[model samples]
Target: MAPMGIRLSPVGVAVFCLLGVGIIYHLYAGVISSRIAALRRRRTVDLRELLALSVEAAVLGGREVKRAREENPLEKSNGKTKGGASEKIALGDQSSHRKMYHLIKNTFPFLQVNAEERAPAGGEEAGVWNHVIPADLQLVGEGREVSADDITVWIDPLDAAQEYTKNLQKYVTTMVCVAVSGVPVIGVIHKPFTEYTAWALVGSGSNLQPRAPRGGRSLRVIVSRSHAGKATRFIQTAFGNETVVHTAGGAGYKVLALLDPPDEQYEQADVYLHITYIKKRDVCAGNAILKALGGHMTTLKGEEIDYRAAEANHGGVLASVGRDHRALLAKLQSADSHRQS
Candidate 1:
């Protein structure tokens, strides 16, 4: 009936129309899926970049603090300096922390950066991250939903304040760490003087930069540069005189030395031991990086340090390259027990 023997019945026309609709539907669905994937990738990148920026900001701000302290030396009494510019030195400890905090907030307005505030928790006033981190935020390594309450951000704008004021610039470090569900997942440490940065994202492994080989002839140990308290002495005694002890500053720097040691006398430290109490801000970033390198950082009893708490770590922290963590922890625990008795 059609021209040149070409003809279409009612059923044939219906089939053709259905095929067209199906093709269109599939194309539309594919476009939406692609867009969603792109958005997720963008978010992950944004979070990583934000963490890096926070560390960088802290480093830059630390320089300002160092200059202020140098310009106005600490007085013999009251620990205050006398000068118009020295006013910053009075607030040196908090200045860097505040600067990094504000920088993150201004740079990324979409992220609800919580202000550090005192709130009532467990029958006590506790400093907590006030904002709720969105659950949809993707954690780099762990494939799990992270609720707002389960995520916390820690910032140490300037570590080794005492060493920094004393012109021991090598020990100073600026660090930022992000923990989800009480586990550190992202960490960044920046040395302002060296301009060297060590960062780690859980499940992504350690930094790929060229680093000196770890392990040496002796059991290399890195202790606190400034605070050599009873804990340090006990660890030294526990390891016996054969161990090589290298004193350095900054918890982050100590961890870095373990990860990327120098080519000098002390190439690397096998263990980073801190016997005294330390704050979450002080060790969170370093511990995260260490864990990424297949290392372990825990208490003398071999328990993981909890980051969700409001208080500091009073028990002690032992970080090792995973070779002899059990033995080292046991030795330290035995020594601690002896001391207690």
Candidate 2:
């Protein structure tokens, strides 16, 4: 999900604990809200506004990523850390994720933020965060106003870090996704190298061109270039050897492949598969973007993911575009049954 080698360490735990704000505010603002009412309640939201702010937040994070690359401020961590969990981390990720979180907190401190990089418990000086919101941009249209309590912001400071470390600029991306009542409603993916951003507000519209129609004789499944052992075997077993599995870097990039044809000569993808470990931050933005285009993204079992889940989106993922999602799921199920028996 975060390139093969990169990982979200234990230090990357809930944001609330990092702030040292105590456990009282943890349920609504830090930990996943397991309340049945929180799950069932629906609130009218002007997703357009949140979508805009999220885009700005993503761009700010992208700037930090670029700076980190130029400054070579990358750092690695261990499995045990005072921050939260112990796992290898990047300084670029810390700075960028902090900036993204800082921006949102400054604007609206009450909103719950789910982030990959965990900062210190006390946080930076008062002068740390400064963000500028863009004034004019025709994004999403016509949405009912919603309360801030039901909003959750998801941020991935630097995706595809391994690729970026290797000077693979194209593979690097920064993403921001807004989830409302467990449903991802807005997504923003920004590429630092090209400075290009693609965003979507579900049920509204997007700034992207139409994706290439699904073609080719075999089912084209795009996957992580970093880790493909399981996905490759699954395609071979489930769809037979005729299936084409294209390997690339970053969840955002793979999702982009499903959206449109690459600048190169390769064919567009029908689905993006990750039959392995992946956190919600890894795929939530892509999920929102794909859904905006009228596509499907869910667990391998075809279950909708709750963004506020305590465990995060830990199961394997299967995302299909411009195809029969149910039919694909049905086929996958049949194959699994045969393999087990």
* Residue-by-residue lDDT tens digits, candidate 1, 121-145: 1121111122233232223434333
Best by TM-score: 2
Candidate 1, superposed: residue stretches over 4 Å from native: 1-50, 66-92, 107-147, 208-216, 227-229, 261-267
Q: Considering only N, C-alpha and C atoms within 3 Å, which residue pairs clash in candidate 1?
A: none
Question: What TM-score would each prediction reach against the true structure?
Answer: 0.67, 0.77
Q: Model 2, 1-341: lDDT tens per residue?
A: 65577555667655636666554445334223322333454543356667777888888889988888888845565455331223445567777887787666655556688877455413531222223324433545565476767788888888876677666777778999988888998889998777878888888788765465646568898887755776688777888899988888788888887877234333368888876667788789999989988889988789998886553555678998888889888777777788789
For lDDT, the strongest prediction is: 2
In order, candidate lDDTs are 0.63, 0.73
Give the least accurate 10-residue stretch of model 2, judged by summed lDDT.
124-133
Q: What is every candidate's alpha-carbon RMSD to the true fold?
A: 16.9, 13.2
